[model samples]
Target: MEMIYRPLLPATQYCPCNWQSDSTSLHSLPQSKHASSFLRTLIAPYAPLWVNSTPATTDNSSDDLECPQANINYRSAFEQQKREAAKKMDATTLMMSLYVPKGRWQWTYQVPFENRPEEDPVTSNRIWSLSVRTARIYNESITYICKLYPREVQWEGFFSEVKLHKTQLRPLHGASTPALIGIQSNITGIQLAYDIPHHSFWIQASPDMPDILKRRCLDAYHQLHAQGVLHGNVDLANILIGGDGRVQIINFHKSRSTKNDPKVHLGLATPQDFNMEMREVHYKLNYLGAREKERAVWENRRNSRQTPSRRTTRRRDKDPYAIPMEPPTDPVRWLIPDNWKPKRFIVPGQSREQFEYHLRQFLLDLEKSKIHSPSEGDKSQGPNRRPPGDRSPPPTRCDLGKRKRGEVDSEDDDDDDDDDDDDDNSSSKRVRFLAQTNHDDGSKGKVRSPPPPGVKRQVPRISREYQNFGESPKTFAIPFISS
Candidate 1:
């Protein structure tokens, strides 16, 4: 079991939103020149003294430029509201604005021990110990999460993470991972701020977890490896699911860079480190899916055992249009007459009445086309029937000679009349015969007999038969003509 740290120091109640120039919320904050610029920008509107005064440089040996000392006390107005109006306030009221671009932070004090929810035991303890809270920048609307660490236990971890963020992890800021805001060091502890989205949450496995999200998580790891950074703990807790469906990697305290870390560069297993992290991610994702599936199975079993009929009724009541999973006990309950049309047949992007109107129109057009179609007697003569006035030339000597030589098959000669009768009909046998004849003529360089003058070659028609209704619909072949 992991040891949970509980800080003895009381949680800070200071909120940046209420900070004023004369306010003493911050005390003796030691920041580098780079961090000072960011700090100045954050407090410029609230603290005129810090902004107008010359910035202090922590990089140099000089101590003259250090920040002014102010009396610090933790007393949050929000915390007071939670204490006074716990019942009236919604639990998610604070979390709702977490990712909202307020250009400012709404810092809520840490959860009190007595009021902490049972579900978030670790969260409360961690927040209390780390002094983790939200912050607001003077002119910045983006919310930033801040974490304070005891100088003795977490200072080393703080500096290591900051170095990686400023170096190899810099490019991944606001993309695959949160961007570091700045760092503040005082005699008490070290504080590191980051621009994490308000809507970001830790990864949790679910049965309906999208494969795209899993792929994104894998891609994030690949990117980290490509940057020569190895996240020592590649667990699910360290992964964040963003509001925009992006996967973000966090908690770089244990991360190492092969480029920056001498130990990583010298290690023989360095190459396998990247592969191991990738495998771990895949395994964890698969495990989460399996766990969720098992949980669902258990829930279904419990529900079925408790109230099978009630559940079924509830499902039917919720979605009346939903298809029944099980057949009705009495067939008459579901069976409908051939002419009957369900009142609620749905068509997407259109109303039921509009869809029904269009369907009736289609059926009317189909009926009209069938009535105007060629008669059976005319169809039996083939669609290629020539006009009565047109006449064929008398058989030439060359044609008579070929016929006498038995070039044409006897079976074809016998079926000539029958083939002509069925020429308008769509059948597989007729299609095959035409295809075979074409193939043979092409391969053997045999020229087919020429057609009568003014007549064209046969064109296959697009025919579709609808047999979904009680009776089969007649095949309506529409001949496709080339442009």
Candidate 2:
């Protein structure tokens, strides 16, 4: 996932808005270094530090550069990213600086979580714990999610295990990223951070672990065959869940089938149809058959025998700035009304990368098993019993300690109460995602945003389509959240 950015390019260099490239092709980059440099110079007043700082290393393989252990490298990248993000005062700041230069669509505005009435669970024997939401993932080019935890007893390890898995549909919104998020400790609470606008996403752990992100995981699998990339997990929660039932996907399609680890089991698997690219690299090393001439011949025969790219599969002659299409005729259309929408960015506050991991397991099922699915492999019946949380990394801080019985006090006394609703904890459904209509006028219209965090906590259940045959328990949202 870190490799998504060319090693030394600044954030603007690989900005999505600069040019819309075929999502499946690595060769179709959005901008060149020279163009990016010019864009940076123009926007420097709004952004002082958004320039290329990747050390000029000849290695070319970011994977080999002390990735997991290189805490210093990760920290350096993060600080640099932060200095670049401070210019965002309002929508125009991002539009002029980040989105336009990059050439992709830019989506902004707080999602339902902004109104969540609750605070992170406060407790000092807290069997349950929640990670700090970074307090600042709202803006940033880099993101980090922890993936390890240790419990005093293995049973704590078990339930804590049940707790941290992003697969379970706990609609609790906090910090998360597109590629990965997790922790490895007995403590059940862990926090993650990410860059929503950038296609390149990251988590602090597992080069292979990013596959577990909700959106990327499922999206990667959904188009595996067309992209010449193999799809792995394809469950509902594995991808980003939006306000209007739209789903966005991620997770590297290049490395699923051959990469499963025998020791971790995680109950993860993929459908059989997924295939890797002939020129793909894995774990920073190339894994295709050796001998360039023989490899070329092999790919030719392979491409000849496989299915042709589908009509639904869209490719571009040159990089386009956005996903374009004629306006859809539907009067109820939220944004542009047409099949011409560019792929939607994963909605903020929802974890799509996590869903992809679960979905990969499902995709393999589609390939290996003979089940018929409503979509890809939706099961008509209840899901097969599997381990809870589908092999998520253990929680590094899995407990919220103990909370007082009186902790559920009303929020009428809180310092800030703007648009805050006081809901009877005993009654009211949790709003899972945001839903609203907006005109180009930028007026705040009616919105069905989620309840505040203080309201009765809603436990998210994986959509039935992904419970088993789909197997991804990640959150799914309303189809259109962007305006």
Candidate 3:
């Protein structure tokens, strides 16, 4: 593909020099020799586009001039050299050059032009580019992600990121972030070494993701933070996970190093202030899990309500004249009887099993009382003494007669009512026992009414004075004795 090179730096800052046949090739330049010549062979096929600072001879005649005047003259000469070099970068060379700075400097290796530079679709950073092809360096094919700063952009971000990649991220290479391959002037190359197809963490994020995968992604960030590098943007889109289960962080254009406190660049915050990146990641994961779980519960309830009964479906299919009925919108309200009320006696803050266990124990106690027979000593102790299970004793004829005579006197009626209250309490206990028994039997219990007039009994009554005054009256005992 045809490559276009826009001048990234002004002529004063960077001077582009054409490759000369008489001059030394970039590969033959005196620099640190690699253990292997693979890098030299890689760049051998591509023509050299630019060269670093060309050495100049100082004229001894200018040494006698004033210090300020001589410095001005030297600066003017350097600028003149840059302008001459800029004129050499003709239209033909501009169309064929890459976006790298105007220098033939060698880094870890050399990259030959495979395709033109394209804007990186994945990066959140404003300044980013992707080479349209991969480079097989040292027998390993790598996806080359490039950081590009054109002429209009500031060079601080590009230089700082390169410093971070070459220094802070060196130890974490191939583990957390991508390894820095090399840089050419305005463009930097890093190795995205994953073998399998990958996607951003945002695309595959789910509450249902395996615990191992979540932990792995989180651990990758911890590893990065340990290197004293803070990823200012801890977004899901910046994290990459491969199909082969590898997790790696990317887009370090916004990252900062706590260890290096150089002059602040590009209005970026300090590393200490941005330490919350790890915390943000953790909270986001928890939010996703909770949100998904709640959604699942709601969906389950809706599906259960929407599913029609098989019997109803069959009936509708068989009846030709049957009218189609829509499902109830509020299923709970439709399915429950109108008279059904919430249970007032249900103990709050208890699980279903706990409530059921306590209720069962109460019923068991009632059953034990019902099965107990009266002891011989208790039965023979006194005529007034009844069985152990009985609470109120049957009143004698004499007591009933005295109570009835007492009711004749209006002042004495209160005393009679008080005495009857003890018997009423005993009757209530008997009713509760029957209710418990009925509960165990799965039937409704009935409250027994007072017997007919032929039976001897003391029945509760309301006083006439209290009733006439329109106030709640006390219970009066009625005498009914039969021999």
Candidate 2, 411-439: lDDT as tens digits: 33663442243344212322322334654
Query: Candidate 1, residue 459: CA error in Å?
Result: 63
- What TM value does model 1 have? 0.33
Worst 10 residues of 3 by lDDT: 193-202
Candidate 3 lDDT (Cα, 0 to 1): 0.43
lDDT at position 124, candidate 1: 15
Please give each candidate's TM-score.
Answer: 0.33, 0.20, 0.33
Model 2 clashing-pair count: 116
lDDT value for candidate 1? 0.43
Q: What lDDT would each prediction earn against the true structure?
A: 0.43, 0.28, 0.43
| Model 2 regions lying over 4 Å from their true place | 1-132, 136-177, 181-233, 241-247, 250-256, 266-483
The whole-model C-alpha lDDT of candidate 2 against the native structure comes to 0.28
